[model samples]
Target: MKEKNANSQSDSGYQRSLTNAHIQLIALGGTIGTGLFLGVGNSIRRAGPSVLLIYLVVGIFLFFLMRALGELIVSDLSKHTYIDFIEKYLGKDVGFITGYLYWFCLITLAMAEMTALGIYFQYWFPHLPTWVPGLITVAVLLFINLLSARLFGNLEFAFAIIKIVTVLAFVVLIAFMLLQGKSTSYGPVSFANLTAHGGFFAKGGIGFLSGFQMVIFSFVGIELLGFTASEAQNPKVTIRKAINEVPVRIILFYVLAIIAILVVIPWDKVSTNSSPFVQTLGATGLHNAGSIINFVVISAAISSTNSVLYSAGRLLFSITFNEKGKWNQTFGHLRRQLPQNSLILSAFMIEFAPLIIIIIGNDAFNFISSTTTSMFLIIWCIMLLSHVAYRKKTPEEELTDFKMPGFPVLDYLTLLFFIAMIVLLLFLPENRIAMIAALAVFVILAIFARIWRKEKTE
Candidate 1:
């Protein structure tokens, strides 16, 4: 492997304390968020068993997309992120828009995770205010992150292990129930649940398509692997191994878990008001299943919030480093190689999650969830476009062994998939407002970038 700048302590002037294990676990922690633990309930309700197919399809496309991302970063190890390549290949305007959008995007997602955390808390303390636990979640994660980068990694690793074990145990429990010919209200614990209840495509084509919106959203944090590239121990080997294993992990964690739930309890029994995992386990006579699943999903939410806050901080630090302004400079300050100022600012915005919950009450999580998913899809599309541009400009000799499969063709197809997702968002009544919000945010940011550029030129 090419080793340029590989030995530098801080390749991008940021601490590189994350090891291969940390990279893998952080990626896992990020991808397997509250989206799976809670949001899957809504998806299962929407499309019945057909949601499984949606998950599989979205996972395949994202895996290809990550390969494009991995190839670009490893090809030029010195660049902090694909944002750098975005500027080089696409233009300064796109890079500027994407940088700000990406930062704001993850911050918005942090808010959504915070909202989910508050919901999880309601499971334990049914009468207590959600904002209380929501506030506590932000404070706790903020403190761990402020301590150090390695601490954040270690914390996320622990969170990932909890979720991993929970899902694995879930799969095993469902299998045991099926082996004993256990039956529930929906019928026996068997694969027949997939087709028994109104058939596999029970909800028909539109219902199946609607599920894609949430299904795709569940994988929003998959690109977090690219974000951790700057801090990884061996950018080349570590990233390659992590990205290469995503498919298997997605299958084991997402696909199999969903299958197990539907197999044990019919899709109709999976309530939007609670976790499918909990509901399935409850069907099998586990009295404490609800509390157990509650803790698992809570950990998943906190894990995602922790990872995304770190991401937003890093993105702000990068954008500020490139801008020439006093506030930007302040936000870019580092202490012990941690982006302390940026993190504080990010945390302050995230703290709004509780207040939003208090005001909006019941609808807050779904609203933020749809908005976050829309923004991430936009970012993913931009990354693929940048990748296509990079391949055209670079010499074949410079391409790494980790190159994207079916290069330009797969790139455009993935972009088309994202477009389809956006269109699907328009079809869902709940997502329409969030979709409009995403467009309005983009337009406002684009105008802001133009003014910033004109001011700089003068």
Candidate 2:
């Protein structure tokens, strides 16, 4: 009966075309990509079986964080996404920082996915040059995004289905191998691999802690769900279902999938250079397994890249929609009811990703992974803090139905977890550069915000 954010329409008049299926699939597609398929190998190498627990722990905190986000968004159905909530509950300064930081995060992340996509393509055509596919992927997805937001959602649905099929198939293959009592070069395909290494915590506490940086990165895009609130066909029902199922999706897709890989193949045998999923399939005497899995991974990367590009556009548009800043006004404009201005600019930014891959080669993934994990953690911190502030301001009766469990306590604990994660990043040598970079970006954004506010006053 009531219109949520009657004035919340995008400059291009975006339609609420994303159904429950679209939002759910987009959430799955966004979070379950390179992090699980490609990055998990490095995590396995660092933490051994302990990586499973890391996923669980980080996932649990993320659940609380999302719960906080869901309640915030539901409280004002008219609001498009969390950016509005951050601005309203927090301050405009904070809202500005959050919006730009989120945009930057998705841009870098989309680039990372593209980098991985090229590497996967090389698995089939080693001589074709990584940048070739990288560029083409960006162009194709850019075109799709420029057409319509609904098309982007539909494309994500297809990409997500490919990933869902691959992971499901991989898990089934593992079950079949265990049933047959088959053995591979790594020895028996059983759960023994989980403990057979140096015990479950084979790598010790330090190694286990190091994995959190990447583990956190793997879950980076889960918050994309909150951003989709504006386009959701039924925000109340769709957002509710999507956010509620996040933990279960993490368990089934992330936790169970990793466990199955470890069970079938010793963690030590998995190579960071290639996907553990690809590696496991190849290890099962499937000669073309590498090629097959490569195709699947290519699809996964494409899926992730597509979603983030869409996210980057929306984030940029949100900033411009709320402010009169020059760049915001430019990026915020729409044509043919699409954020074409923001979408093309975001795509252009992503084009540089292919160059980064060619320059650094394999290290591109590692660098982007570390940098983004730190950045996403910071974003989560703000999200939770904003939620707390929102709760304090709103009447208890208003949040009656979409209540966040463990409100103040869980909220505080989630914030602490994020702080601990930032501290942990400092101790990690590989992540140290990323930590510094994240800090520098935050400082720069804050100073810029201060100047903008001062000028506005004058």
Candidate 3:
């Protein structure tokens, strides 16, 4: 049997077109999405100002997670995606299972974003159907993705700039308000708001724990930088820099922004029904603040959908590359040096967003989005385990400089942290069903993988 070269490109034609700037912005754009723009209010309402701590804790673990992944990518830049590393280190069946599971979750995530896009559009155009905006947005994004990887990077770059500017401007404006001793309908803009309501853990320990599910969801796409390595201009420099900046991005974008909102609106008064960004801006008497924030939120959703589609397409192509069968041949090959077929199939799957919305109504978006957090927790655990395996198999001298800090100890600790979060999700009543459903999907995939292995052997 021939040894599979971990550094060999699985497919022939992916262009190394994503520059450092593109990779940086893509990392920024992936971490800041509708979850932060629209869903933070729910987290705040659940955990109070302690949500700050929740964000910080989750951010730290995720930074460690990225370090493990960075080490893997730096060790083998020629591999198309992290899935390749999984296959190499953790058997072919596990790789097959993880790849398809990841692709499925991404498609569902894109659908949720599409559903949110429709709702955001309804804010301005009340008469439009909920699905129309989502359908149109998916169509346009699919077109952009099909054009080329560079074009996709360019669009994400533009979208990320809009998000970063909005967040920075909000934080700065809130700081000025605090310094000026500003007053709003709720109360004065003061740091006291953070603790005055109920001493930080306003909702008690349960609320703080409950906040993890959503906050963890907010960071779902952070690993997207791993997917970009195959197409990135220089994997070592660009990937390492992007991963190293995870902590800074989390603090600046999530922690500071949430702190600003809490200072302006007491934890008890923060509306869980809508974006705190829109609420904070509106309270400040900014003319058309709601409209402007709405536009930004819409762009955030589109940015998420675009990035997920790009990942889904590549993942599908990677998993199916060089496999036997008509389906594999069709999706595995690149057209015009791009994964056009795989991309089209992924986009087409997202078109079901409208039908899902029509069938399940508004709950569809929350249900789909919630399920992804549970699914990703499982995937992250597997990736961490794969990292452990890689370390055990490779001699120390063969390892790259971009190694995971604390080596074997921190690696196991990170794995345990993720496992604890998974257990927490199962205990939460609202998320229990979603978590169980995700587990069922994993089991089903494992069963299929077994059959697939048997067939391959035969």
Candidate 4:
């Protein structure tokens, strides 16, 4: 066997014991949980069964996006990830922007997932303080993050399993209910559920446009492929396989799951209480419906929280790699070649913010989404620009294995879609303030970047 060297340190202390099944389901878990579980009604209200169309449209765009990143990252065995590719294809300035913005994406994603967990626990322990589990969950994830890369991989594998099984089980139970001719006050299971109420696109053109924001939110963390590039056993093959299969997985897990739920409950009647998963399964009068989905969601949230910390911690580690960062070059070196110091720091900050949020007792979704919405848009913009640069820099011939299907057209559509999502966000009553706040965060981060650069020059 040839000497097997470790790649860059973005995967944290975790290494690549993850098998094909592990990577696929972990990718599934990263994107499928809390949002799809709970946000189904929100999507329906925006586009109705038309939201199913939205899922296909958005999933296609994400497939191209992931393939673009995967095509570039899979070339060498160095474990250099998409962030590294950004630096290589674009200038250092562009790379730094991508890396920093991606870091924000990771942490804010963690905050969002952790926020969901706190809310779930409050269901059972109604009298107990919300922050107690928030505090404890953060602590536990932080400790787990400090271990070697494979340790983290194993943990994510198990966490992702909980979600996959629950969703599959939920689908089966829905099928069973429909077969039994079950009826709710809403109506009975009938083929008409697909076409009867408002004829699929019940909300019309404007509602369909408005639904993309939540649809994009459902697909947020699927970029775990880029983050895991550093530790994939043979990213040359593993990342390729993972990225190549993006389209099918998105359709199967997200699209199919949504179809299952819509068939079981009319788009008009799905509840906002708990997850749509709970409402669909609970209708079956199965044993402990609330408890079953609550457990699945809890596991999904924990998996999301864990995966984000691992991905974000690695990006934090990269900052010190710059000659300008406070840590010496040695800081970039991981013991046993893992990202120990960076993981510790990233884990601390991630946990700290939520404890503060918990202490403040501001548990509303909009409160957290405001800070993150801007952060997410900023990252999306960076990734889009990075791809443009990649297309410009990389020669045409070596692009053989995989390239985005269309040059400027598909890429441009995806870009425009992201812009429209941001615009739609402004129209939302609860999210409107967040849209405004996100603008301010962008300005502040830009100004901070300028000042930091000036100080480096001085």
Candidate 5:
């Protein structure tokens, strides 16, 4: 299938120890996280049952986006990350900006997960300090990550399994409850709950539109499959498999799970302050159901933080690889074949989440999450543009078998979807500040890129 060193080891010193199973679960781990567990409540509060439509729309576009990325990864497997493809096809300037921006994106996302960790812990230990759980989590995850790539993959494998089983069980329980016509405090568990509450568009068009910000945030780490390309055992097969399953993952993990929650609790009744999963389970009057789901959501948040930290570390290493300067030299190189320094630095950055909590208090998670959603939307737009440039520049005969479906058209559509979402964020009163801040970061990075280029030339 026109392979070009598709299984070759990366020159960047990453070990290809992650097998097909690891890759699959890591993809699952990335898709289902604090965004789904905790953030879904926010989305439900905003859009009601219409949030399902939002998830479907975003999922379809992202699947196409991953196909474009899979083609790039298989086309030249030796590249360390998607940023390398960006640098090659879109020019070093764009690469420089995107690399740092993506690193910041992952870091911000990690912070959001950490913030969620505090909230999750509060369900059990209301009197404990909010920052205590996140601090301990970052410390433990950092050590595991610094050990080796395979170890990180193994940990994610276990975390993903926990999440999958819990979600599936929840869905099945809800279905059984519906079939029996069981009644909760709210009402009978039935699909009718989806439509009975405000006729599905209870919040109207603006509310539906508002859900996109957090729903998009929930899908932020989906591209983590791209970062694992270098470390995956068989890049072409594993990455393609992972990317191809995006639709299924979206349906199972997001669509069905959210449906279960809505059918049981009604969208308007779902708690915006905590995980709706816990709330739904509690409504069933199952003993310890609330506590059990709370534990699962905590695990979900930790799993997300772990995955993002892994990506953040690799992103930092990729961005600084072989660059000049003391900081670059410190974080750019791997130790014992692991990106130890880079991971440490990324973990260090995550420690700021607690400090952010101190400053913004309860608003920290939403603020950090909104900022990440804005940044990632911009990053996704750039990645799609790079994919388009790659196709135009490369000869038809040289392309891989995994080309993006409906080339150029679907690509442009995907780009438009993301850009429109960005515009939506800009207009939303709550997200407007974060959107503008993201744009400011982009402009600042562009200026630095110009100056860096000029300095190199002189």
Candidate 6:
């Protein structure tokens, strides 16, 4: 009944081809992850129940940041990609950096996501070697992204639906348990748990702020909106619709989810290494809830990797297509309605990166988690910095319709939170290495970017 933007159309007449369902899942698939499911305990340990405060702080910053990006996206219909916004508002050099950096983030995280999928799989299929299952998991995502965008969208939609349903089920179970007075053997779980153990601010100022390291990672995929701009069926309405809902989702999914968990489980014994969803559900005496949640997490991991694989390819293709960039057209070739070469390379990076860890006999899951903290933070900082430049350069009227509510203030606030998260990483031994590794990678990329630019100039 709906005539949507067709991928078969050339860029000359290209429009947002993605349906509303695709857009919804694109955001949810990337946002709701094994990280939230499994990692809340580490967060609780990091800041006690104060982790909910961290979620609130970060959530506010992201809301404005997305609004800024949304304003830029809607300013001009032709400016589809985030790169396009940065390019117009910033410059081509900055554009290339955003493109390559965004692609790299996807590649790095995809590696981690694949490794996580294998780890989650082993929870049930213990007899299997990590590499075999990991490789297969990577393959499944690869095939899906290589398929038509609609196919990829359908798969992602289904996967995100499963995640949403699981979380909704958790909320329902929590309400049911509370309503029925399913008292815990240790104690009747209630709001008292928020402070009974150590109080909400038990971590005090530094610990509360530093706890952001884990908290920030949970919000990494919030920018999934920027990636989908080019494909969104109705950019203005869709972009606004997505931005309007983010604040609510962050509260319900992240903030409220934290409160629900802490209410059910005691603070001191929480384990971030496993899905808080699993333990929370299992505590409610729901049979096989843990295994079922693990299954959903594996699917979520695969879905995230798949969507990001496509996004990475698109970014690389954009970089190569621009004459100002160093890469050649062959790498950017658009064929059969897909950036085939870019897709192939993106898939290769995602799959191959993990294979190295598997071959080296590292813990596949830990290796993936290593990139979880720092990589996304690096991208988030760069985006905010880029936005800082963007606001000064672009005409005020262009951004007037959807401009950030508290310019300058919110911009700086988001920056502060991002840095706070980085600082929080130093307090976290578990994720410290990931943070260090991301910085080292950034240094390497910066050096190469200079060389690439020099070569292009020559």
lDDT of each: 0.84, 0.84, 0.88, 0.69, 0.91, 0.71
The list of candidate 3 runs beyond 4 A from truth reads: 1-11
Candidate 3 — worst ten consecutive residues by lDDT sum?
1-10
**Worst ten-residue run, lDDT, model 2?**
3-12
For candidate 6, what is the lDDT?
A: 0.71
Clashing pairs in 1: none
TM-score of each: 0.96, 0.96, 0.96, 0.88, 0.97, 0.90
lDDT of 3 by residue, 173-272 (tens): 9999999999877779999999898899999999999999888888887898898877776667888998998999999999999999988889888765
List model 1 lDDT by residue over 57-94, tens digit each.
Answer: 99999999989999998888777667788888999888
Q: What's the CA RMSD of model 5 in angstroms?
A: 1.7
TM-score of 4: 0.88
Decide which is better by lDDT, 1 or 6.
1
Scored by TM-score, the top model is 5
Quote model 5's TM-score.
0.97
Stretches of candidate 1 exceeding 4 Å from the true structure? 1-8, 184-187
Q: How many angstroms is residue 351 displaced in model 2 relative to the true structure, after the best TM-score fit?
A: 1.0
Tens digit per residue, CA lDDT, model 4, 1-458? 13234442333444555556666656666767666765566777678888889989888877777766665565543534466666676665556666666677677667766776766777788776645665678778878777666777788888777777877777676677678887754568665797888988888887787677667767777777676766665556566777777777777678878888888788888765457777777776668987878888888877777887888767766655645545635456566666777677666666655665655564444356445655576566567766777777667875546566677677778778777767777876656776777666566666776676778789
Q: How would you encode candidate 6's per-residue C-alpha lDDT over 157-237 as one tens digit per residue?
A: 898888888777778778777777776534676888889887888778866765676566667667767667666676566
Question: Which one wins on lDDT?
Answer: 5
* Candidate 2 runs further than 4 Å off: 1-12
Model with the higher TM-score, candidate 1 or 5:
5
What is the Cα root-mean-square deviation between model 1 and the actual structure?
A: 1.7
Colliding residue pairs in candidate 2: 4-78, 5-78
lDDT of 5 by residue, 186-236 (tens): 888889988997889989999999999999998998888888887876778
